[model samples]
Target: MLQMGIIGYGYWGPNLVRNFNVAAGSQVSMVCDMNKQSLSKAKKAYPQVRFTSDVNELINDPEVNAVAIATPVFTHHELAKKALLAGKSVFVEKPFTHTVEEAEELIELAEKKKLKIMVDHTFLYTGAVRKIKQLIDDNVLGSIYYFDSVRVNLGLFQHDVNVVWDLAPHDIAIMDYLINDKPQAVVATGSGHFDRGLEDIAYLTFYYPNNIIAHINVNWLSPVKVRTTLIGGQKKMLVWNDLEPDEIIKVYDKGVKVTTTEGKYNLLVNYRSGDMWAPRIQATEALRLIAEEFVHYVEEGGKVVNDGAAGLKVVKMLVASSKSLKNKGEMIYL
Candidate 1:
């Protein structure tokens, strides 16, 4: 069994601990957190696991073969780098690192150490996303035309990062997975209502090759929570409503056909609309899947779906988007 050490017991930490503890071939050997209250709560819940206040203790623990980091974005690089250099595999939370340079360095370090680095891109492991990937791979959607998403909610505003950094990572990671084409450029616009100078609401647009395009709208000021994505393709279209309890994904056999008439000036347009079907998606916790994958990567050498390379791609998009946001929606190349 692979012994695991976890850092941070706040927010997403508990979920990671629970999943890794239950995952096959893995066990939570130790947990570290600076907050005494968090440590006390963790100790109470998991009596078998060791708890410590100093991060170095957990990183250097002889029993720990890997370190899972659930701290804020800024701390990811240092923590992961130290864990990797300590001869332990690293699993870090989403938005891998604050910048692309940091992610690149960690990736290089992990490679040199012959260790695995799994990025906690939980959404990519979701059943819905998995099904979508299958459909796309099967050519059921034909050629993708556009990807649009809206993720917004009230409160839960982060002090360390803006709405784009807080919310856009999910969609950006999803886009990077579903669409194979690389983004050529990005443009973003947003504003901050408070004095923090961080944008609470943002709009981001990405241009890809083959005339493909994607747009993401994220906000922390919305009155109601909304999680929706629309993917349009030449053969069919899809709508995913994450808020729905059932039938979250709907695929429509709909498209438009254009033909040129005998005369160059004349044109014919036709709209084809057909049935809409919802495929059943397996109900499984994404974090659990991620934890299992981490174990598999550690025990058996294989490529993980959301590895350091994938995380680096997402971080590059985040960095480019931030630059565009600062430049008043000026387009920035990736």
Candidate 2:
């Protein structure tokens, strides 16, 4: 069995521990957190595992073949470096690190050490997203036009990161995976209500080649949680709503077409609207699928769908968006 060590037991810790504990061919050998109460809870819940306050203990443990880090954005680089230097594989949560430089260095280190690294972009493993990919591959969505997403929720505000950094990673990762074009520039705007430094509400726009653009809206001040996105194509459209109980993904056969008259040389547009269809999505947990893939990669060495480069792509976009926000929504090239 592959032994695993988990660090940071605050918000997303329990989920990580539970998934790793049940994942086949893997065992949670140790968990590390600065909080004694968190460690106490882990001990009570998972008496089979060990707990420690010193992160170095978990990194140096010979039995722990891998480390899954769910720490803050700033501490990711140092902790991941320590684990990788100890000759253990590393799995880090989203927004891999604060800067692209840190992410690039981690990628290089993992490459030199021949150690596996998986970024927990859990949504990519979801059944709905998988179906979207399948439809895109089959040209069911047809030629893509634009991508738009709005992910807003109230009061889970992070002290260290802004709303964009906290929430945009999800949308950015999904866009990175689903879109055929890479973003060339970023323009963003945000406002800070409680804290003067951190932004609580933000809007980001991406510019890609061939006029294929994308937009993201993230806010922590919203009274209600809203997770929805729409992808428009020439032939069909995809409406994905996370709040829907069943049939979260709806495919719409509606769009506009333009034809030029020969004699008049004028552009005539035709708008078409048809029935909305919802495709079947197997009810599978995204985290479970990601856990299975992590095990498979460790055993078989297959390239993961959410690999290092993919993480880098999302991080790069975040960095650019932050810069744009600082400059008052100025378009920043990537």
Candidate 3:
């Protein structure tokens, strides 16, 4: 069994403990947090697991074989480096680190140590996303034309990172996973309403090779919450609404075709409209699968889709977006 030590018993820590403790190849051995009240709450729920206020105690524990970092983005590099140096695998939260350099350093160190690093891109494991991946791979959505996403909600503004760092990661990671082509450049624009210097709303556009484009809009000041994505293709189109209870994915058999006429400058346009169908999605919790995959890969050396390299790609896009945001929506090459 792979013994697990979790850092940061704040918002996301308890969920990690619950999933890893019950995972097939892992068990939660200890949890570390700076907040005494958090430790007190965790103690009641997990009496068998050890609790500590000092983070080093958990990283240095001989019984722990891996560490799951549920802390903030700024602290990821330090905590993950300590665990990797101590010869333990690491599972990090999304937006991997505050900067691309930090992510690269941790990835190189983990590679040198032969330790596994899995980023918590929980959405990738969801049934909806998995199904969508299948559709794209099977040529159901032939030759993707564009990817557009909108994720917005009011009032959950973060203190450390802006809305792009906080909300755009999920959509960006999803777009990165679905599209095989790498983006050539990116443009972003946003503004901050508060004194924290963190933008509350942002718009990002990524230019991909072969005419594929991706646009993402994220906000923390919307009147209503929306999680929706549209993928347009030559043969068909898809709509994914994450908030839907039963039907999360709807594939439409629709397309537009252009043909040349007899005249030199004449042209014809044809729009084909057909039926729409919703694929059946498995109801398994994505977090549970993520926990299981981390443990299995650490124990058996299996391949993981959301590995350190995947995290780095998402970070690279984020870095480009930040640069563009600072220069008033200037295009930054990747």
Candidate 4:
């Protein structure tokens, strides 16, 4: 079994530990957290696993073959780099690194050391996203026209990053995975409510080459939580409601067609509307699949969908969006 060490026990850290502990071909051997209360809770729950306050101890342990980092965004590059250099595979939480440079450096280092790296983009492993990818790949949603997403919630405000950096990553990663098109430029507009200088509400728009466009709206000031995405295509349209208990994805056979006149002076338009269908999706836990995939990569040399390169793509968008936000939505080119 491949031994795993986890850093951080707050928020998302527990889920990582639980999944990795039972994931095939892997075991959680050590957990590190600076918070005493968090460490105490972990110790009580998992007495078999070792807990330490110092991160270096976990990284240097020979028993640990891989390290999973669930820490803050700022600490990801350093911790992951150290783990890779110390001959351990690395699994880091999403938004990968703070910038593209850090992601490129770590990717290069991991390649040189022949160590595997998987970024925790759990949504990519979800049944809803998987089904959506299948539909797009099967040509059901032919020639995607646009991608529109809205992810907003109240009060889990982050201190380090704005709402765009905090919530837009999920939809951005999903867009990157489903749509095989690269974004050429980004335009963002947002405002901060508090004196912390971090935006609580933001709107981002990405321009692609083939007349494809994507828009994302993220907010921390919304009274109600909303996680929804709409993908419009030439053949069909898709609506993904992440909060729905059942039928999270609904495919609508709807689109508008345009035809040129014989004289080329006038255009004819046609709108097609058909029945909507929701495909049955498997009820598998996404984190477990991610954990299993990580283990498979570490042990069997399998392919990882959410690798460093994928994470870097998402990061590139995030960085460009931030730059646009700073410039008051001046359209920063990627």
Candidate 5:
């Protein structure tokens, strides 16, 4: 069994710890948090697990074979590098690292050490997303047209990263995994309506190498939480809403039909609306599935759905988008 040390028990730490501790072929042996209350909560949750305030203690522990970093965005790179350099496999929360260069360096280090590096892009592990990928592969959606996603909620303000980095990674990662095409350029526009110098609202657009397109809207000032995505295609369309209780995902058999009328100057755009069906999703926790996949990667060193390389790709896209935003939404080529 692989022993894991979990760092940062704040927001996402408990989920990772719970998932790892119960995951097959893995156990969370140690947990670290600077907050005493949080540490107490961690200890209470997993009585068998050890607790520590110093991350180095967990990293230096010989019993731990892997370290899971669930800390702030800025701490992921250094902590992950230390874990890998110490000859331990590493699993980091989404976006992997802050920049593409950091991710690439970590990937290179993990390769040199022959250690597994997995990123926690949890949504891709969900049955809904997996089925979506399969449908795309089977051409059920036909030729891709556009991807539009809206992820917004009130509050949960992050101190380190802006709204785009905090919220858009999930959508970007999902888009990258679902589509086979690569993005050529990104145009982003954001404004800091809340805290000074921090973007509270942002919109990003991706121009794929193919003629496809993707647009993402993320904000922290929305009145209500909305996790919705629409993938449009020539054959059929898909709508994924995470807020739905039973039917979180619905496949809409709809598309825009264009036709030429008699003596018409332009083609008429007809709306084709058909049926909506929601396939049964495996009702499993995304974190648990991610933990299982990490163990699977540790045992079998082949391609994984969210490996270090895939995380790096998403980081590249994010960095490109951030650059575009910094340049007043100028088109930034990757």
Candidate 6:
């Protein structure tokens, strides 16, 4: 059995603990947090699990076989490194680390120690995203032309990272997974409205091979929350509205075809619009799937979709976007 040790009991930490504790072949051995009040609250729900204020105590516990870090973005590298050095497999939250160098170091250390490193990119395990991946892989969407996403909400702002770093990682990871092509360059623009130096809103564009392009808009000052993505392809199009309770994915038979004429100036542009359909999505919680996968991979060797290398890929995009954002939308080549 894989004994799971979780650090942090705030916000996302509880979800992690709940999932890992119930996952097959794994159980919550301990939970560590600096806030004693948070620990007290968590302890009530998990009377069988141990709680600690000292993170080192949990890391050094011989009963713990794996560690999950749900702390702040800045603290990820240090905590994850310590966990890896302790000879335990590590599962960390998204935006893996503050920088690419830190992510690389952690990945290398995990590899050397022969430990698994899973990044908690929860969306990848969702039924909606899984269906989308199936469509793309089956060529149901044909050749993808462009990917555009918008994730906006009010409040829930962070002090450590800007809107791009905070929100863009989700869509970037999705786009990276769906689109097999690697990005060639990136450009970003954003501004800060409050006393905090972090940007409240940002726009990023990624140029990929074969004329494929991706754009993401992330904001923390929107009047209404929006979670939507549009993918245009040669044979069809898709719209994903995450807020919709019943139907999250809608695939449409729509596209534009160009016909060349005898003359250079003579050209015909045809638009095709057809039926739309929504595929059924499994209602299982994504975190539960993540927990199960982590335990399975740790006990039996196998490939992990959201491994440390995948997290590093997302971090590379974030770093490039940050550089472009700082340079006033200057394109940065990846």
lDDT to native, each model: 0.94, 0.90, 0.95, 0.94, 0.90, 0.94
**Tens-digit lDDT track of model 5 for 1-334:** 9999999899998888888989989988999999999999877778888999998999999999999999887888999999998999999998799988899999999999999999999999887888888889999999999999999999688888888889998999999998887889999999997557879899999998668999999999999999999998889898888888889888899988878877578679989888988888878888888898899889877889788999999899888988998899999998
Question: In model 4, which regions exceed 4 Å deviation?
Answer: 262-265
* Candidate 3, run of 10 with poorest lDDT: 260-269
Q: TM-score of predicted model 3?
A: 0.98
Residue-wise C-alpha lDDT for candidate 4, range 196-260, written one tens digit per residue: 98999999999998999999999999999999999999999999999999999999999999899
Runs in model 5 with CA error above 4 Å? 259-270
Residues 1-334 of candidate 6: C-alpha lDDT, one tens digit per residue: 8999999999899999999989888999999999989999999999999999999999999999999999999999999999999999999999899899999999999999999999999999999999999999999999999999999999689878888888898999999999998999999999999878789999999999999999999999999999999999988899999999998999999999998888757899998989999999989899999999999988897998899999999999999999999999999999
**lDDT at position 58, candidate 1:** 97
- Worst 10-residue lDDT window for candidate 6 reads 257-266
Q: After superposition, how far is residue 13 of candidate 2 from its true place, in Å?
A: 1.2
User: What is the TM-score of candidate 6?
Assistant: 0.99
Give a tens-digit lDDT track for model 3, residues 241-325: 9999988999999999999889857888899999999999999989999999998898888688899999999999999999999
In model 5, residue pairs whose N, Cα or C atoms come closer than 3 Å (at least 3 residues apart or on different chains), thus clashing, are: none
Q: In model 2, where is the ten-residue run with the lowest total lDDT?
A: 258-267
Instruction: Quote each prediction's TM-score.
Output: 0.98, 0.98, 0.98, 0.98, 0.96, 0.99
Per-residue error (Å), model 4, residue 4: 0.8
Could you tell me which residue pairs clash in candidate 6?
Answer: none
Q: For candidate 1, give the lDDT.
A: 0.94
TM-score of model 1 (CA atoms): 0.98
